[model samples]
Target: MSTLIAIAITTGILSGLWGWVAVSLGLLSWAGFLGCTTYFASPTDGLKGIGLSIATNLSGVFWAMVIIKLSSMVSLEIIGYVITAIVAFFMCAQAKKNWLNFIPGTFIGSCATFASNGNWQLVIPSLILGVVFAYAMKTSGLWLKEKLEADKLVEVRKN
Candidate 1:
């Protein structure tokens, strides 16, 4: 169980990174791909967010209904695809220049996850984990920048 949890956490982090990259590239289709990848990669709380975003952004409630019905017959995993498609649709609608503008998507995704799951425990943990992962990425990026700067200075001194 512990190992499974660890795997889920790691998968979530990777998914976030994928999502960040996809958004940065400003590719709506790839964003959907990333969202789907993230959902399928981790059997974690994040799926709840993916689920809601997809549901909200889909063309119509009819499509959403079909997805749910088909998902029940085929497998629960299909739910992730349905949700991802919806998110992609919404992202396409927005089409902003700055894809890495994480605030809107993050807030919307987190809220959607909570609404969809209606499980306080899962939602709470997901929120905490998502926030942590975001901050960790920021901090790591900063560290990388400092390390590169230090390396450059050392090379200059040697020269």
Candidate 2:
């Protein structure tokens, strides 16, 4: 598990670095991508954020493409958005890796991209950063827990 996690982090770091390069070169917009990435990357014990973010973002990309292609078929714009939301919800609810958190993850990824002018390219890096940072957050929490427990042990011994 540790080795797999380390690899995941390494992959995210490499992808995020490339995203930075793209931003610096003016090849991409950094605003929405970075913002969404940071918000979703919040670290926790089980890396749930990263998992959910990845799944949601990937689905968001697909939905964005579909909406772009299909929205014109409908006379009502709101219907298109509703259709998207329903499909997104269904997908999120079905995701096995993140079934528990699928709702927020799907909404965040889909709505964020939907609002970002349907730029899945920009969404990719944000997803990477979000996933990697989630790992970092989990690791930090574990380390902090260990240190606090050690401190309690020391205090008990001194008494």
Clashes of each: 2, 0
Per-model C-alpha lDDT, please?
A: 0.43, 0.58
Model 2, 39: alpha-carbon shift in Å? 9.7
lDDT tens digits, residue span 71-157, model 1: 566556867687757754644454342332233443344343434443333333343334344434434445556666788899999
The lDDT, on a scale of 0 to 1, for candidate 2 is 0.58
lDDT per residue for candidate 2 within 94-123, as digits (tens), equals 666543354455555666567668777776
Candidate maximizing lDDT? 2
RMSD of 2: 7.8
- The segments of candidate 1 whose C-alpha lies over 4 angstroms from its true place after superposition are 1-110
In order, what is each prediction's RMSD in angstroms?
13.9, 7.8
Query: Against the correct fold, how does model 1 do in TM-score?
Result: 0.34
